[model samples]
Target: MIACDNLTKRFGHFTAVDHVSFAVAKGSIFGFLGPNGSGKSTVIRMLCGLLSPSDGHARIAGFDVAREPAAIKPLIGYMSQKFSLYDELTAHENLNFYGRLYGLRGAALRRRYDELVGLTHLAPYLNRRAALLSGGWRQRLAMACSLIHQPSVLFLDEPTAGIDPVARRELWDLLFEFSSQGMTLFVTTHYMDEAERCSQVGYIHLSKLVVCGEPDDLKQLPVVNPPDTRRIDVTCEHVTVGLQAVRQLPGVRTATVFGQSMHLLVEASLSEDFIRTELARVNIPHADIRPIAPSLEDVFVALTNNRNGET
Candidate 1:
């Protein structure tokens, strides 16, 4: 249960979060996405009661963020992009420390630590120093420490950054497990795939919330792809060099590299044959060119481009 009522935050003359408003239902994962400096972390700080809002307000689990900052602190757990755990401390030691900070001790502390160890698959790394653990394992240790107090809500800012794909998936599994248990999770991520997994998503752009909705709803938004345009996926050689050349093609709306392939938003009237000819003209070799569904990235990109046009 989280609610924001026109929340705004400013620093000197610059506004970091601009009149943002959204509600996150209980037992759901709300993904926050934006480019760097888009105020994603700023909003999270205000919601967590770590940073005061310049105008308006937010309530975390019914507690007013500005009025009850202290009460809000114990009800939520926050993990940032970097590992907050001590590099010299072992996984178990980190958990024990945080547990003690939360006033947990004796049998209760031991039990909570044990539960986290198992839940995060940290039993094998219980004695491993945080510095020695891989990026993913270190993040897992940080997560276990954050949950030492069993907060009702969790705020993760770029939690999967710099971690491998497998590790990122594993982390999401744990987050989903938390959601199933009625824990409210607010996560900020750049990975479109991770955003797709969220029950709800809010896209922030230029310090404003541009769009917030279910993944499918956002994809289906008419603003994402114009009526006269459609996206095509192409697996081509020399992808790095082809991107520049492809963008210059007539009737090509936009072209961006997607993993090992390229996603081109082209005029709908342009046939696949025309696209092939254009690529051939530029000496860009490709094996396949086909239409695909709008992805989460597509929604955000369109929203961003539209926002730019409006301004």
Candidate 2:
């Protein structure tokens, strides 16, 4: 339902999105991942017809985003990062205002308002001013307003940013329900776990698309799983110290601290004894080492490093 062909965006001498291309199937949840200032939001703006692409084009549900913006506007809904809500307006008022903006009047507006309130469970806070609502409540209000018109596609830019874990999970549950009902979703997030849950994910770096595919397919990329090397997880005390020790080893390709453990990419010839002995020398005597698969994070880090080497 979404397609981009060499979509490029530039501002004077700086390029924000560079010839990026990808496609999102209908009812699919597509996760766009990247670091801050990686042009993730820029691409979303272009796709939503809020910004024009410098070269190439993007289409939504068969309508060109740039050329046929009017036709595409009613077909998509957008929930910005800031939860764009007026502080003085109550939640109920906000919904009614947006519904009217979408041209829903009288019976249709009332029906959509009721449905959104039920879907988001904003009944209790409907009469409360937007400024008084908590971050999670504000997010629900924003999403409800966006869906007031029942658009076929939804674009959410970091929809879970700053929200609590429970709220984040709840939001994803709602998204799943929407996707099940055949609404295409385009979401940008920095959370690796969230990216893993997507049907397809695209990683962007330095204004370029580094990779795009299913999470499992991305993990299988040769660049992520190098020849003659394997990944291992080390559960030990002082993970930072363990990471420093293993990263300096001759055959250890890379080591990154993950929570209370460390994940290391090392040559297949490097045995557990070798790693154990090294950690022992550094006062980390007890270490649990086990073979592990590359995670979505591992895929992105590997691809980003490769891209860095190329430039």
Candidate 3:
């Protein structure tokens, strides 16, 4: 239940967000993807009433962000990239403080505190000071504090940044749990895997949203065809030589190394047999050769690099 129409934010002569518009349906996790300094956080702040937009307007749960900011504040919770908890306070104490700020007190505060502690698995460290907690623990505590008031809408700005893979996955699981309970999650993340997990994604580039749709829909956007510009992953001991050879081959448009493997953008006319025969002739020992689906990162790279020619 979130909507924005031509939302724009400017600072003097510079525009941070330019005419970005999108809607988040109830119970959906809408992922906002962008690189550093792409104005994602700026747009999020404007949507949450933390920053007034220089142009246009946003409505959250039916309340106008510009004219009725106070009305919307109580219905939403925001977790910023930075840890927003008292370093000296215990986990329980931090939750209590935020609960009080939201007007929760006595039994109500105690109940919410307990619920959040359990939900975020903070019981074991309830008496631990925030500064003493690990990064992952601190992140969980911050998320718990934000939800203590039980707001219907949650805005998470790079919530999983710098956390370990396991921790990030756990945090995503918690977000999906909240969505299943009818909470709307508007999240901005740098991780393509995380974006793929979202119900829908909005890609921001140069202060504007260049793409918005389901992850698969965005991945399927047509690109310039070398006819055979298919992606194939191959693992070989001689990755450097293999890449060079593949790039020089007819029907092969691009060959790049990804870790220990190689990703080839080849023509559709390049059959599996042809590829195998070429590798065999070169005496290259490949672990595997098969077509691989393009990831969100691949689509993003293609889209952002050559927008003029995209379909």
Of the candidates shown, which would achieve the greatest TM-score relative to the real structure?
A: 2
Give model 3's TM-score versus the native structure: 0.91
Better structure of 2 and 3 per lDDT? 2
Q: How far is candidate 2 from the true structure (C-alpha RMSD, Å)?
A: 0.7
Predicted candidate 2 versus true structure: per-residue lDDT over 150-223, tens digit per residue: 99999999999999999999999999999999999999998999999999999999999999999999999999
lDDT of each: 0.90, 0.95, 0.87
Q: Candidate 1: give the clashing pairs.
A: none
Per residue, candidate 3 scores C-alpha lDDT tens digits across 1-311 of: 98889999999999999999999899999999988998999999998887898988789989999899878888999999997899999988998889989999899888888888888888999899999999999999999989989999999999999999999999999999999999999999998789999999998998989888888887777862234478888887777877777777898766768889887778877887777667766788555787888777777777776764563
Highest-lDDT candidate: 2
lDDT of 2 at 3: 97
What order do you get sorting by lDDT, best first?
2, 1, 3
TM-score of 2: 0.99
Q: Taking the tens digit of each residue's C-alpha lDDT, what string does model 1 give over 1-311?
A: 89999999999999999999999999999999999999999999888887999999899989999999888888899998797889888877888899998899899998888888889888888888888999999999999888889999999999999999999999999999999999999999998889999999999998999999899999989898789999999888887677787788788888889887898888888788877777677787564888998899988888888889899
User: Candidate 1 at 35: error in angstroms?
Assistant: 1.2
The number of clashing residue pairs in each candidate reads 0, 0, 4
Candidate 3: give the clashing pairs: 227-268, 228-266, 228-267, 228-268
The residue ranges of model 3 lying beyond 4 angstroms of the native Cα positions read 224-228, 238-241, 248-250, 254-256, 272-284, 308-311
